[model samples]
Target: MSKKQWPSWGHGEQAQQHYLVEPRALAGGGDVRHVHAFLRACGWRDKTQRGGPLALQSPDRTVRIEYQPAGMPGGWTIQGAAAPGRDAWWAHLGAQTPVEIVAGFTDALTQPRAAHAPNVWAPLREQRWRRPPETEHVTATSPDGSAWVQYRPSAGGGAMWWSGAQDRQGNGWVAQFTPSTPLHLVEAFTAALASPEPVMRPLGHVPHSARLRTTSVSVLPSQLGAWQQARITAARAATWASTAPRNARPRSTAARHHAPTGGARARH
Candidate 1:
């Protein structure tokens, strides 16, 4: 069997720059997108093609890891921010899995670069290791019974909402929002359902009415009776069908808006 060729180990140009080059092959040649997502999930921003050279920079922009892959040694250099300057910490990825590669890179960051570890890995590990959010799903209907929206808890800290209003053309919009977003925005979104004409807003960035400066309230799915649950589902379907031009009808004045169990109640 042939032995793996590793990169040379030595100190970087700067006197204070620490360097460790080890041979570590990936289990399967590393998947760049997977690595990028994992890093992004950890709070590392992709600075590729952003001035200077292409690289992934830490949130503070002090540390950088250029995406330069070398086939000879089966690894790449990891540059970290140091007090005096940046240090090059190279690894031979040919011998290690992607996980091990990141572990080693993180472990090698000590002393001058110690702060970088927590600044990067702590958030990364917290996101990757922590238990995912437990979501309680529910549906919200508009006051006129002409529009409805489904709210579901997202992986991170936010809510994903989908308009239950389908036009005669069978089109609608889906939106993901952060907790900080104003509730009025959502109300405005569902309100579009009753428009005499089809809502022309793009689904990707649905426009909302003027921003409400009030603090956004939490929306939770409440326990519901079997009868109420069935009615809610039926209403959502009915509203979707009513979007057709031929089916348009007068809005009911007795319509009541339904808020998910844990959501804030509207005050008269």
Candidate 2:
């Protein structure tokens, strides 16, 4: 590349837009927008913008990089692009690595410009590195009518889900819950009704309500009892249905005064 002396502004200068940095040298203030566009293209956010030919000053030190703005009289000389007095080459320097000459006074700063890294972020790698755990296979209906599932590869016990399915480290399961959702027909039968005879099919009515929500329900071959079937149907239907209210006429317009068509009035 070639070195640039203190030069004036050039063409293609506009406002509130992004521009690109050509591989060659920049002429003036228009290069600032181009520099921003380039950094954004490379996935760098939280950038800093500087304008005019002031000495490169970072009182806050929060600035990761610096550049000039568009449409101003003083263009730039990045790494000191087209700076007023001093040579721009001072920016192209580093302890070892070199700063890229974006424009006159313009530069794409790398490391050493930044001070240090944070502590909390030390544990996580830059990218997603490992996969999640697997699900175990110990799911069954509970005696108390609530769901009962065991997670596997666990040292006898692990985090459990209501849905009953689990693996050692993979995704989890989801179980149904209600004020009164039962796992077995026996639970519903006991809650809904009492009978002296043995239960052939699950006594469905024994449970008063299926406090839990259900999408659909059907009688199984094993659940061939009359009372159990009735309880299931009633629970499924007990949901609130949405409906719109009737449109009403305004109260002021509801009534009107009437005048007599044929008039005949006399007083005695």
Candidate 3:
């Protein structure tokens, strides 16, 4: 995708920037490496064996992330331990879920934020999702009503708190977030779902079921190469900064100038 094809941001003058009427769906299984990079940046430890699925644990052991290629239930699983006045939570991304969409959850997880309850339905609402009066559920459906998101509040005992399905024929993918999951995380996920930014996928990689909802565009191979390189560079920089010593300081110019003099001052 070219720079001009990228989505615009903000409102008014900024909104005037040319934006695609429909989002482009890119090809490829969601990249797990990006998730790993974000976790590493936030002090999470990798515990994957040579041939095992990817696994990571938080510095405090309060959160866990795992990615299974087989994806019997879900390919990506993230869990948080119970905290003060808050219950334990789990989120799952199906194997077919897009990396850009999955990144929304991980990105929000790594960000620093004040403690407050976020309105999980706000993003969906802004996108014209319907909430029946006095009901606990909010729903958003695709134009053809094939794909939809159903959000149920205060669900209990193995009930799905958030459920998303991509096709009516049961051939597409599904994702779920369990009860007590962080609202902000769900908000981020919904925001990403409602975002106008196109997801770049190769023509061959785009799913047959989702083609109707996506716009076909000629994305250069170099664009994917550059995108991957930029992500690698950012992840490396973040890792370096995170691991740097807090107490370390650079030598002053005076110290550099006096290095050859040892403890004695040179006579002028």
Candidate 4:
């Protein structure tokens, strides 16, 4: 299938539409639509009921994803089981966590292959996060000490093995990756956490407690509308491609019949 392209705005216009907002002011559930689209592309089935949280299950029924728009403390949860009667691995992202960061985890989850021994802390270290030497467990903290990530190799007693927090005592958010959770997913999440790109949030949606610490520029309504339309278009395209008849071909391709009669193809 041909890849679907998302819409883009001029750099100057896009820059004008959005201002940097602290991660703490991030609103949850914003990425739910994109997450649903990708999972559907991968053959996951929606099983949500009326008035319930959005829920989807893997084709094999071994994994599930859920998002509760009204659930503040934990709005997003994903769990996987290797077999029946076995313990499940789970991950949680709080409501305030940025969707852009959460996308990192979901994107990795949908990849075809698992990463080999990914170093989750390397990305944070490269971003100048500090880690004390000789610690029993791996840990890294942001420069301003408002955020931190940790991994506990010995967490076998039902404790979370991988965890992160932003403004823990304030109106920020938290995420937890259980011991059985894939390291690659954790790496992706951390990589996004360390990214310098700022997230966009509405000024009114910014939590009152975080208003003092957060700063944001106004985003034009038209820009937001354009972005929403683009997202819908991409999702519809993916759905159509995934559900199309197996033997069907694009009309443009079907109409092509001439064999190449030109000189040597362009060099790679």
RMSD of 2: 35.8
What digit string (tens of lDDT, one per residue) describes model 1 on residues 1-268?
1122113323432111111111111022233433444345445667777443336666566556554444443333344444444232222222122322333343222112232212221322322322224435555443333234455677774554443322233232223323333333333322322222211111122222121112222211222222234434444445444454654654553565553211112232
In order of appearance, the predictions have TM-scores of 0.25, 0.16, 0.68, 0.68
Q: Please report the TM-score between candidate 4 and the true structure.
A: 0.68
Quote the lDDT for 168 in model 1.
35
RMSD of each: 29.0, 35.8, 13.3, 10.0
Model 1 whole-model lDDT (C-alpha atoms): 0.33
Go through the candidates in order and give each one's C-alpha lDDT.
0.33, 0.24, 0.59, 0.62
Which of the two, 2 or 3, has more lDDT?
Answer: 3
User: 193 in model 3: Cα distance from truth in Å?
Assistant: 1.8
lDDT of 2 by residue, 1-268 (tens): 1221212223453211111112101111121333443334333453343543322332233233433322332222222223354222321111111011221112213112223332211111121212123435433332322223222334543432222212233221222222111122112212111111111111231112222211112222222222333332322222111111225323333343222110101111
Superposed model 4: Cα runs more than 4 Å off: 1-18, 23-31, 37-43, 70-73, 83-87, 114-116, 134-136, 155-159, 209-222, 228-268
> What tens-digit string does per-residue lDDT give for candidate 4 at 199-247?
5545355444433243334444455555555544544555566568967
For every model shown, the clashing-pair count is: 11, 40, 4, 0
Where is the poorest 10-residue window by lDDT in model 4? Answer: 259-268
* Model 2 spans with C-alpha error above 4 angstroms: 1-26, 29-31, 47-63, 69-268
Per residue, candidate 3 scores C-alpha lDDT tens digits across 31-102 of 566567666766678988898888988777888888887847757888999999889999987776666667
Error of 4 at 103 (Å): 1.3
